[model samples]
Target: MNAEQALIAYVLRLADNALILGQRMIEVVAAGPELEEELANANFALDFIGQARMLYTCAGELEGQGRSEDDFAFMRDEREFQNLLLLEQPNGHFGDALVRQFLFESFYVHLLDGLTRCSAPGLAEIAARAIKEVKYHLRHHSQWLIRLGDGTELSHARVQASLDDAWQYTGEMFVADAVDTVVHESFAGPDLEAVAVLWRRDVAAVVEQATLALPGDQAMASGGKDGRHSEHFGFLLAEMQTMQRSFPGATW
Candidate 1:
């Protein structure tokens, strides 16, 4: 793919990740054990959805197509999406969901921090705005993990298991592909290798503070950024696209 195509793909990948994760998070809207957490979770979902909208719009502009954010979101088939496999995994339990967010946010904060420095048109601005909110998201999730980790023995074990279950998927976040290569070379975009280093250090520190052990390196699952996703992704796509597909042009 040319540089332009690579950039569009990269932006869409970002949008897809945010949109899918936001959908996953909203599933627990009324299910959070605490009312405060429920509200915060809902707000966090909105933050991600809002970021997805902005990034989609930017991608649409870059593509010079008539497509809008909704078109990119609700009109896409399962194979068209490029979200991370980690984001598509089921929310098994409260600790499962919490650990998932903590892990992703740890990497996302660093990713966005690097994106904020990208010279690509529209990317740096969006990344700059997003990093501000993501910093808070990272902080919130990190504190919660520490609390749950250092809590009761049961809490510690479950979240530790959650950490291990989610660790395999973590490798994909830094597995820079062709799009990553083009963006970095042409636009001074994120260096995933560098981000990986920062992510490892931050994650190790948080894991230590939580009195948790980090999972050892293992075979990493990938391909989501290439439009290949887990089995759960089809169901997610079906639910997210139902309204738009059912009512073509319906809008507020």
Candidate 2:
């Protein structure tokens, strides 16, 4: 693909990841175990949704399409989304959701930090703005990770299992596929391999502090970046797109 096409694809991938994950988090908005945490989760969900809007708007402009951010967000089918499997994973329990966000936000903060230096001016600007939001997201989730990991034995075990079950999906985040190659080589995007090293160190430190064991590398799951998603994505899209799909351009 040419530079512009490559750039749009890259941006959409970032947007899709955030949007899909945000939608998943919204699923548990009223279901959080604690009142404070419920507010925190809602806050984080909105943050991701805002980031997605910015990225999607940029992507739409890059594509020179009439489509708006809402069009892309609320009109797409499950197969069209290019988010990682981890983001779409079910919120099994409070700890499960927390671990999922912890894993993603930790990696995402580092990635956004690197994106702030990208060769593309627009992308760099978006990254600069996004990094601020993601910083707090990391902080929120990290606190929870420590809380659950260092809490009662039952909480610790449940959260640990959440980490273990979700561990395989983490590999795909740093795998550097075609879009990654194009963006890194041409647009000076974040280096996934380098980010992976730092991600591991940061994640390991948090896991240790949480009194949780690190998951062993057995096999890694992949393919969310290539428009492949979990079965759960359909349900997410069904709920997210219901209003838009039913009304077709109707807005408040």
Candidate 3:
């Protein structure tokens, strides 16, 4: 793809990641262990959804399409989405959700920081705004990882297992592709190699502090960014788009 096409795809990838994870979080808003936690989870979900809106809007503009954010979000088929496989995983449990967020945010925080200085002025501005919210997100999830990891024996074991299961999906975050290459070369966008280094160090430190065993490198799962998604994605997209599909052009 050319540089402009790659730039639009890159932004859409970011939006897809945020929107998918945010929708997953919405699934368990009422399932939080504590009321305070539930409220926090809801707010965090909104933060992600809010980020997705901005990104989708930016991408729509960049594409010079008449499509709105709702069009990009609600009109897309399952194969059209380009989120990471990690974000589409079921919210199996509280611990599962927590590990997923912690893992993704760890990498996302670094990514947005790089984008804040990218050559694309519009994306740089979005990244600057996003990184601020993501900083707090990282800290919140990091603290939860420590709490659950160093807590009771059962809690520790469960969350650790969650972390291990999620690790394989994490590999996709740093798998730089042609889209990444184009954006980076043209816009000084994020270098996934550099992002990977920071990701490992930060994640390792958190694991150590949580008294959890760092998972071994294992076979990685990818392809979500290229429109190949996990089995759960179709179901997720259907549910999320139900209202829009059932009632076209409906709005709040």
Top candidate on lDDT is 3
TM-score of each predicted structure versus truth? 0.98, 0.97, 0.98
Candidate 3 per-residue lDDT over residues 1-252, each given as its tens digit:
889999999999999999999999999878888999999999999999999999999999999978899998999998899999999999998889999999999999999999998997489998999899889988999999999999999999999999999999999899899999999999999999999999999999999999999999899999998999999999999999999999999978
Off by over 4 Å in 1: none
> In lDDT terms, how accurate is model 1?
0.92
Question: For each candidate, what is the lDDT?
Answer: 0.92, 0.89, 0.94
The candidates, ranked best first by lDDT, are 3, 1, 2
Task: Supply the TM-score for candidate 3.
Answer: 0.98
lDDT of candidate 2 over 1-252, digit per residue (tens): 777778888898899989988888888888878898889889989988999999999899888878899989998877778899999998888888888989998899899998999997588898899899889888888988999899999989899999999999998999987778889999888999999998999999999999999999879888888887777878888989999999999978
Error of 1 at 143 (Å): 0.7
